[model samples]
Target: MTATASPTHDAGARAALIAELKRSAPHEAAMRIGLEPPARAAEVLAEMNPAMVQDILEAIDAEARSRIAMAAPRELAAQWSRNAAYAEGTLGRLMDPPFATFRPGSTVGEAIENLKSLVRTAFVTYGYVTDPEGRLLGLVTMRDLLFNDHGTKLSEVMLKDPFALTPDLPVSDAMRLTLNRHFPVYPVKDEAGVLVGLVRGSTMFEEEAFEIAAQPGAMVGIEKEERIATPLFGSFKFRHPWLLINLITAFAAGGVVALFQGTVDKFVILATFLPVLAGQSGNTGCQALAVTVRGITLGDIPPGGASRLMAKEFLLGLLNGAVTGVLTGVAMFVLASSQDSPSAVMLGVVVCLAMMGSCAISGISGAIVPLTLKRLGADPATASSIVVTTATDVASMGLLLGLAAVLIR
Candidate 1:
């Protein structure tokens, strides 16, 4: 009789072959292998690259995908389906259902027994106590369960009214809540206040950190979904729009300079300082934009309080402008004097006034652009740098050259 391969050996060999196919072939082929055992497909997909898993799932045939979804565990299906249901940056996508929970009436001994079994397969940090309707009541830490009497009721020992996150809350807002109150796991609730899942604080932190790191690129018009593995054409499509916008803005700045061509020719020295003024003002605007975006993301700037925030940024702009303006004026005075310009002192005064005005406007523009976008229901970081830079460039050039035309003449 021919020797038979054990079920374990056969499964292991199948898994190995599927993994190799996943690495070497299109995701559809690997997904077909996963489809063979629909019940295990969720686990296999979870282990694969999450960045591409959603696309892979979409590529599968509708009937096969539906069968796999039906066969998978409810929580696993929910997690996989979250991409379609929730907005990309919400807390729902970061939550998982693989958590330890118990009824409020369960005894400490029973909870411990349940945990013992779950601990072997899942990460068990806290025991959630919920009411009959699955509304969360409290939490019991592992340490509490260990130290309490085995006969104690979980309801009597649990910490009531613990911090929880709603499913629709943005992940950035969720992260701000954890800055002062750190918990390993936070319960997630639906609109009805029933506990739906749990979000790991570490996971939220990682996702938020990645988002924050990507903000600079996002400001420059890079898509958040574009990864190193993105195809060449994909990257080109993602990047072209921003470049076109930047080009248009550049032309606007050039138009401002063309309007001041007469002044630039009369006082060639003024031409030398245009870039200096624009660069300084652009940097100042970017600083304010960074702070405002961070504040908006963290929920620090509440609704109806944007005016106050804008006022603060505006005041900061004026103060920073005055300080930097005086120094810049002195440098312009010295440079013009060395060049023996007849209107050296007047040129210094013109530069000082221009710097102050440009810096002030840049600061206000930075804060206002993001806040306005948020109010209009657009992404605060979507090509904001392009807009703000264009504004500062136009303002700086218009002020500097216009002033030179008036004051130097």
Candidate 2:
């Protein structure tokens, strides 16, 4: 079917259009409302008055309510349930409760009679068959119901072993299961196997898109719906802690600085090049760390394949080091030419070597930290950024200062 016209120009125009359209045909209006591009959807939903949402919800039947629910702000559903956490964890929290169902033994005639009393298209389908224990048996399509003899049993023709999930499972998990298996309604059950609800695979997909927009740094894979925000946040949040820890580690490098303090005091020129070496090392290490983190999160590095990944990161570090070292060394040599000291050449060499060593260490740490966190039941995302950033900081100082003490002094 052809799609409906959406408000492409202004928020007020879309809202006005939706309001007028709902008055005449609310279901059509509901579908049209969702069809607007997502940017408009969030903006409209965020700022649009709540009274209008209530009006639209009141005008529609259950099926339409479910559709509207898919697009409605998550906070709206959370309020309906009276618990913000309700929408936080699982697809079951987002599902429309008390959906229509019938026993498997029920005759097609009986099912039709029940369906006839209900509004057409209000329910998902007529073949909504249930097992003896009230578990979903299979969908009985409307076509099948209309053609079959009234007395035919639903169990006789019902598709067995339909797609399903449990209530307590996370929405991320549900989305992954549905996408991988490619089913429509994933029946959700309780611990006792009692069917609580069905998660529409289509709706699940839509919710994920909504989530990706709302949550900062959230990323869902192309192949599955496993939420990867932990790593992003982990990398960002833990970075400070890692920096603090690296501060403690930096003292070791600082001790090296202390050892060379007399030499630096005698030849103050060494102090000028110190920051340059440290800065170059920091830059190289950060570059290597970023690559390692991105690769691990994208699953380009297989789980348990840390060694292989480490080798790759180390190689990248070496390449980055060689190119950056030459440029930085040459730049330092030219910049310090007026110093008239052979120590200037030695300082440049120290920086170049230190940068290469620091980069290699950062790359190896970048790969190892996330893998170690993941293995220990801690989220790798949370820990990777912190560990890598701090490691880079400490390694940067360590390499620069150690080289200064060994060579420049």
Candidate 3:
């Protein structure tokens, strides 16, 4: 608990520890590793999630926590503590404390002198100008600091009413706002516009990138925690449940086909088109799903935008279905004529109509599945592919068989 920052520590070990801490769930896993007697607990903790660090520190022995915190420079420990109070996915969770600041009346010489000491343990990117109550007024760039005369007051040189991110802003929303600005660091403010902390562009982007990367796996029921580096047993533990759920959904699709066994038996050729229809419908749904997920991830979906998104996807599916249907219908007609069937023309027409209808439903399912999951407070992409696949399969096979049963029977 009282260990100082020793010069010698294992780099590999520290990195492994940090990776495990990041991969850990509920911060409890982090707490166990946090209690490990690393040579520099504070520094190791600093490299990890602030929210996790805060939870781990709070869970451990108070004496140990305080001593470990004391080992780090005051600014970092304090910042991590404050950042923990925010939710895991918000900007506040990623902020570092604003260590270098000066009052409006402070001269450039005074700011430079203070930064001389501040840069030793921390990276000083920009100097902040704030009122006595910590309301952010402006930002003083390093170039402005050096070029201007030492006698110039901070108020005169600083950029007034600087752009800032609110702590509660979701990382996706933050990314949308800052995509073009590309500033090295952004100051974070509370609802009252009081400067609270700073978020590095690198850190913010990296966090969002991890979420975006996890989306592919999440779509098919893969747990977000599984990574290429994950242990075999751990990967199995993460994936087994989702695979089971996917199987269950698959059975639902199968059941729909089974219910119309008589229809399929009477018209053996119907079996041929079932898979084709199902595959086409499933692909259409997947396309819609991908776009909708991307929109949500990038914060492109506006308020009450769900209906518009679904409608757009539906129209695209309708157009695509009609085009692909003509080719499929021609194939159906050729097969039926070779068999000398009486209803060749009608069979082809049924296939075309079924394609259009199934695709329309599939496209809408794609948008609805993820949107519904998000509304239910689950990850938007989690098991979404499974749900959409089931919906499309049932619609495709059921529609093709049902239409033939009614019109041809």
Compose the digit string of candidate 2's lDDT tens values, residues 106-196. Answer: 8988887877765453445434676678666676777778788999998776767665687676666676566568765566766676666
Candidate 2 has a TM-score of: 0.60
User: Candidate 3 on 288-312: residue-level lDDT in tens?
Assistant: 9999998888778889999999998
lDDT of 3: 0.85
Off by over 4 Å in 1: 1-41, 45-71, 82-84, 105-117, 143-157, 302-305, 334-340
Most accurate candidate by lDDT: 3
Query: What global local distance difference test value does model 1 have?
Result: 0.81
- What is the clash tally of candidate 1? 0
> Against the unseen true structure, what C-alpha lDDT does each candidate score?
0.81, 0.58, 0.85
- Sort by TM-score, best first: 3, 1, 2
For each candidate, give its TM-score against the true structure: 0.80, 0.60, 0.88
What tens-digit string does per-residue lDDT give for candidate 1 at 63-175? 77777788766766776676446666788766677468889889999999988888876667888888888898899998888899999999899999888999788888788
Better of 2 and 3 by TM-score: 3
